[model samples]
Target chain A: MARQKMGGFNAGSMADIAFLLLIFFLVTTTMDTDSGISRKLPPMPEKDQEKSNDKIKERNVFVVLINKNNQLLVEGEPMDVRLLKDKAKEFIDNPANNPKLPEKKITDIDGKYFGHTYFVSKGVISLQNDRGTSYGTYIQVQNELAAAYNELRNGLAMRTFGEKYKELSESKQKLIKKVFPQRISEAEPKNVGGGK
Target chain B: MSKFRTKKDKGTPPISTASLPDIVFMLLFFFMVSTTMRQQDLKIRVHVPAASEIQKLEKKSLVSYIYVGSPLQQYQKIFGTEPRIQLNDAFATTNDIRDYITSEREARDEKEVPYMTTSLKVDEYTKMGVVTDIKQALRKCNALKINYSTRMLSSE
Candidate 1:
């Protein structure tokens, strides 16, 4: 019996194995990174933190509530998310300057002047959610709210600084941010109208 | 003269197959390098909700993740089916969140601390109870930069 020595290992199936691994990775790999709603969390309330709710008038407070049903209630009335941005913008800009809106025009040393510039600190958006609210609906509401602020800032930046909000210099961007500081205040999740 | 005008068939010339492995190897390396392994073997099943508007969280190195979802199948018997929070590699209650945020901040350069952000990857259907608690804890730690992880969808 002649024992024939085969040279090393088999390479016949190597390509098949590589292709299998490549396909596995190709299907599972996620190059499109996770994106999100970037928000600044409010600091933990201090023991002596002053409660200033009395200072903000009813018209100055744009209260948005999301019951467990994922339904939106802007300023105590049930509203659809579709109408949220405009309602929020109207409230923030107070285009009508109807003292009824949470918006107010004030002079700031930043130098940019406008006919209907709302005082950033005067307008407040208080958002409350239910314990049973779906994250998707909650996020959509947040996106609409944030989009309202972004558009306002961007429009103001375009008009005041001759550049988009994102394209402005750091100092100029800071000024815009200071003027329309994001003030989405979250309230405790209430067990409003959803399942126990 | 005819040889110049007419092509001679050497019984169908064989195409070179030598570089096949090299080409495939190049692709393999590219994927291997670019592919980020599933970090923090998720104890909770997090399917981030979809949204129309999204912002990219800048400074990848300054970002940390907090996942919230119902317990996985095996752990359901012990941890129950209720949604739970997972910080880094393990499941944790809200009590541990402050520490987690502090440790994550501690890992960063001092100057970069202000730029650090926490990405909350909460499942779409998960209750917001746990999420609110985590946020409160994060706020106490002054890790106020929060990014609610969401998937981007078109057509509203």
Candidate 2:
């Protein structure tokens, strides 16, 4: 019997298979990266612990209240949301050493992070919002407050190490965070009218 | 000039497409490496708020998403226009958050439980009352590490 010579398989359909895979991946995968503002909530208090009202100085507390209408009442004065960052920075840094501003405590820094001691602010930003406030406004306020802290840390990092805060080593970043700890305390939400 | 003139009878040669499949396969591999498969279909219409101070969440496997928004057009008739919370594939109430957290923790490695993060993707126009309730539920369950999922604000 005489056998026919074998020919190469056609390769034209290879492109079609690749196209099918590409389309499948394009439809199944999401290109958007997830990002957000990270926060750690305070742990639940024990039932047995006494509810002691530890007194905090009025000057050290920066009260930021958002009413039901989404209007800001910062330290009892009506202000715009756009200006909240500068106000927060001023309160945290107290650069002018104003008598009414938060007091600074002289903290001893370990030689590992810094050779000399630094002055750490004792400011605590107390944020209270009404239940009727819009979620957008709430996040805006939180973002502005976080931006204030980041800017202060960046400035200090630049002056001290000539590098950005994010670029610093983890321990060194912790040292800088010690200088300006993000002390935003959120109070429980309250019903302030204008709600169903 | 005559040397450069082409013969009229000999038409232009057809370009070879031997590399076309290779190029397409390269694109397919790139998409497979860089992007992640969508985990679930969204029942709520969520338009996350924007912010400048935001951080990219690391370790996608460790994150548990909590979506808060009004129901889509099809579900609006049954669910009403009010904002609702969605966990995994179904609508959930604030009280369901604790159970959700427990199940999420149980599904992962014990060592990774501490590093687990709960991401709240809330719509911008929704009221804060629902968000606060969710927060309280999370706190009760001892899931303290939370992220308010927001997009990058272009203004900078």
Candidate 3:
């Protein structure tokens, strides 16, 4: 009787096996990341709650309407989409202290703007779109509105903290947000015009 | 000339492939970790609109996707060219959203139910009527947190 020793297992094919697995993953892998405009829809109104009409002043509400033709009507006036951000920013900030823009409430935020009462805009962007409006146009309008708020917050953060809003400490960011809160109120869509 | 001739004769000593597997394994691990496998085959064509102000959807495990788009060419005969909602792998109507939400909620940890987000990956060209219906359905089901899934638009 003779005992036989096993030769070293061939690892020459190991590379081939790994290559196969690598190719499989490559085929199945989806590299695109998910990103988007996050929003919180208002909770369904109770039967009684729907009847209660807490009126918002006309000056404080910046009405943005999009029609089926993708036309932009801002505050009852037709405006170009390119001009929406600046218009929104002006409505929110009201740097000139214009009486026509949204009224600002003086609040002591107790931060870098300490002791000084900062005027927080009490503005609400009311967005209403026709049912037949294209999703692309709707998203574009939403983007512009969001960008307006972001720029305002960024400007405030830079002025107070000398940094971007995203770079600031949580509390500091909160203060800036308190000054320029994102208050986009989406109204129920209406069939203002016809489209498929 | 003599040095060059000797080096050529040795022929680079077969260029050691001992680490070939290691290299391939490294690449394999990278792909495995950095990307997610395609979860469902798309039944419709969805070209998400581009937006300048966008936030990355965080906590992917707590996110569920609802696709809204017109049927692809092959599906047009059966599903028609009209835009429709696709939940999971099957075509669904707005009415089916509640059940879908319920099932999706039940699939996750109870504590995480509140944190769950419904991402709407709707086509850009689709009319808002269908999207509005989806939103209303989601609102009724109390799935308030939503992300309008979009790509980044270059700032002009």
Candidate 3 local lDDT, B1-156, one digit each (tens): 998898889755766677899999999999999999897999999999999788998899999999999999999999999999999999998889999999999999999999999999999999999999999999999999999999988764
lDDT tens digits, residue span B82-151, model 1: 8898988888989998888788878888999998889999998886767777887888889899899998
| Model 1 C-alpha lDDT per residue in residues A1-196, reported as the tens digit of each score | 2345655455556667777878788876667586898888767778998887756677778999887778888887999998999999888877766867765546463544533444654788999998778787888899999989999999989989788998888988888887787888887778756544
- Output the better candidate (1/2) by lDDT: 2
Candidate closest to the true structure, highest TM-score: 2
Please give the DockQ score of every candidate, comma-separated: 0.45, 0.73, 0.75
Clash count per candidate? 1, 0, 0
Q: lDDT for every model?
A: 0.81, 0.93, 0.92
- Candidate 3 or 2, higher TM-score: 2
The interface root-mean-square deviations, each candidate in sequence, come to: 2.9, 1.0, 1.0
* Candidate with the larger DockQ of 2 and 3: 3
Model 2 DockQ reads: 0.73
Best by DockQ: 3
- Candidates sorted on lDDT, descending: 2, 3, 1
lDDT of 2 by residue, A1-196 (tens): 2344455556678989999999999999999899999999999899999988988899999999998889999999999999999999999999999989999988886665556577788999999998889899999999999999999999989998899999999988988998899999999988976574
When 1 and 2 are scored with DockQ, the better candidate is: 2
Against the true structure, what is model 3's DockQ? 0.75
